[model samples]
Target: MTEIEFQKNFSQLQYHLYTSPLPHVSNLHPHQKTIHAFFMLDHLREELQRKNESTLKTVNAKDFNLPEELHVYHSLYPLDQRQEKSIKIFGYPSWVYKSVCSVDGRVYCLRRIEGFRLTNEIAMSTIENWRRIRHANIVSIREAFTTKAFGDHSLVFVYDYHPLSQTLFDKHFSSSSLQANNHPQSGGTGVVVPETVLWSYITQLASAIKTIHSSGLAARMIEPTKILSTNKNRIRINCCGIMDMLTFDGGKNIHHFQQEDLIHFGQLIISLACNSLSSVLNLPKSIDYISRHYSPDFKNVILYLLNKPTPTKSVDKVIAMIGPRILHEINSVHHYNDFLESELSQELENGRLVRLLCKFGFINERPEFDMDPSWSETGDRYLIKLFRDYVFHQVDENGYPVVDMAHVLMCLNKLDAGVDERIMLVSRDEQSCLIVSYKEIKNCIDSAFRDLSRRK
Candidate 1:
């Protein structure tokens, strides 16, 4: 993805993580929650600015305190927004980040915790235990250190950045006309998911869970949104490790909760086939449509997983039931394509980028129709507006985003990075005119948003 597109997607991801309704948080009034959310956002922006502006010097072992400092760069995006809310990792509510390592110019993901009164011994021991875990499907915490650099008591654990993603939620909920309006089981005029694909996804995920189970760990959240799809028909579970911290609430080990994980996984499979979870568990008969499309064997396995009374089966057995792929090989490959255009979609797409860029003074076309993208303020703004207006849809004031990141990323990937067009910028504050190229403006927009957002 282009830098601009990645920032957009990152913004959307933060929106999802932040807007997740905390209905259980009854103590705070609605306005208070909104205020708190914005406050948390400010904290995130400030921390990001500090990290971005600070000089990232190399680590010195003799004089270096890994806890105090280890030159971290390009981690301007703060994963934590609402500090008042306890976000969990493996059951521990901690902050997480996508960071660039100054030492080796490699990117990494880190989980953060305000280590208030936390001891290094406990932190190191936890990190060591996590490093011992070896699972292809599960993300493991590799390195850790304590730092008061940002504030009081901050413990950070770093992990590899696995960006392979197309959340299970989007795979089913995407605006692709075929997937949206054509699921046969969902009464759409389309065939149900190929048995091969369904079985493949389940088999791969089952193996991953099996490994975690063997290690005596349960992926507490196994729903569609929490799972990520990668190359080779693989799906990795995300947002783990903090469930126990949340569920246990520092109380005690809860073994039966593991069964809850199994139950959630079964629901995921059903949702995948059915397309929606409307009256699923209450009426076991709701699953009849699945049987109609899939084979009796497939239906039976799904029913067994969904049926609680029947003895729970292991992942190995689940795979055994759907033994080797004998038929229906999928030779067709999938690619991200969102280029198709509709008036509403185009308007929505343009509106967001237009208004957003206009706020930054990048738009100078007077907001009229029949305008060429290059006529805009800069190549960056011109290209951004052109792409947005032509490709994506406009969202309502309070509406959630309808355009998917895959679509944005796909369109961005097709762009000619070498193309450069110049545009003039007359700053509103200074009225000073400056000649700049599209590429330069596009790169500066992220920093502009960061600086402007803080002022707001």
Candidate 2:
């Protein structure tokens, strides 16, 4: 029989045998065991063949086409007006065509191949996993299509388009001549700003990283460039690290290599924090810090072994040099202050002080303030009036509002307490500030006055 016919017949036979229940076997002679092993090999080969055939059929380029009735949602530019540009997939052996989606007008990255050796079931499982994961930080998978084009099967994974630009690394390392101070443009319409927008981008990225960690998955490849800031304060994290490295023959011992991802994440955080600090301090930009700071711990060790000088390259060192510690301390204190403020706000929202403070013009009325009711029902109008009264009339013997801790706490307490109670504080300085509501102040003062009267 020809090779093709032999393969087909062998596949058919193995499929039947493997599907059948295993025969009970006693201790067999070497020859019998060899025969059994041969059958096992045949079964495995047939299974592999089936898998390859399934993959080839699915990836056939002819099977895929743009779906009709494509709905446009959140396109950066006019879908009908934007020109479609094709990008060649460099370094990949597969023929992939990437174009902007006319329906959504987002960049649609497509991988089209004549054949693949991955099974349809495997592909389906991967897609299913992708669908289950949803986060503001993660790029949403809009749709996937498998269709035939000119007798060739094709598969496409559709993701929300994120405009690509010079990654943080590219921007930092590329030749100075290519560096222009113009607002860096990305996406189709070039409406997004990169420089003035990085703070929100960094925050969104941290939130996304937090989400990923909560999902029991480590984002292995977290670098500045891999993070894209989408419209509406959302961020898309590219290069997810949850892939099976072994499946792609990308590495050995996939489980052990996960530590590399942890180091990378730490490096990313350090870089983001340092950059933010530098910008805040109005310091000159420097790439040396980022590069030296992000060098893998193992790489630093290797350099030491090779008798090469290595910088103090660790996240801890970078954090120490930068103002992260001071920021951390301040944030912790601020968070505690916010907690106290929230408590005061809840009390005010419950109308505990409505009767006591209304005489002082500190009534609860809905105001044109941005404070959310979900955050605090003490109406913005009430807070604003209370703040103004406290600023003007409330002062201690030394001319300081009695309520002062942090901004949030100070605002809430002064609002809940009448301006008359504010006279107890010595000064606005944190050390002399007393963060207490009107009720607490009244009880303390009333008790003091009664004690004085009895002594008299």
lDDT string for model 1 (157-204, tens) is 677665434567667645473356565434322556667777777666
Which tens-of-lDDT digit does each residue in 77-158 have in candidate 2?
2112113322222112233333446664446534333333345444344444455667767765555555554245544445
Provide the overall lDDT of each model, using Cα atoms, as 2-decimal numbers. Answer: 0.53, 0.40
Give the TM-scores of the predictions, in the order they appear.
0.47, 0.32
Candidate of highest TM-score: 1
Q: Which ten residues in a row have the lowest lDDT in candidate 1?
A: 328-337
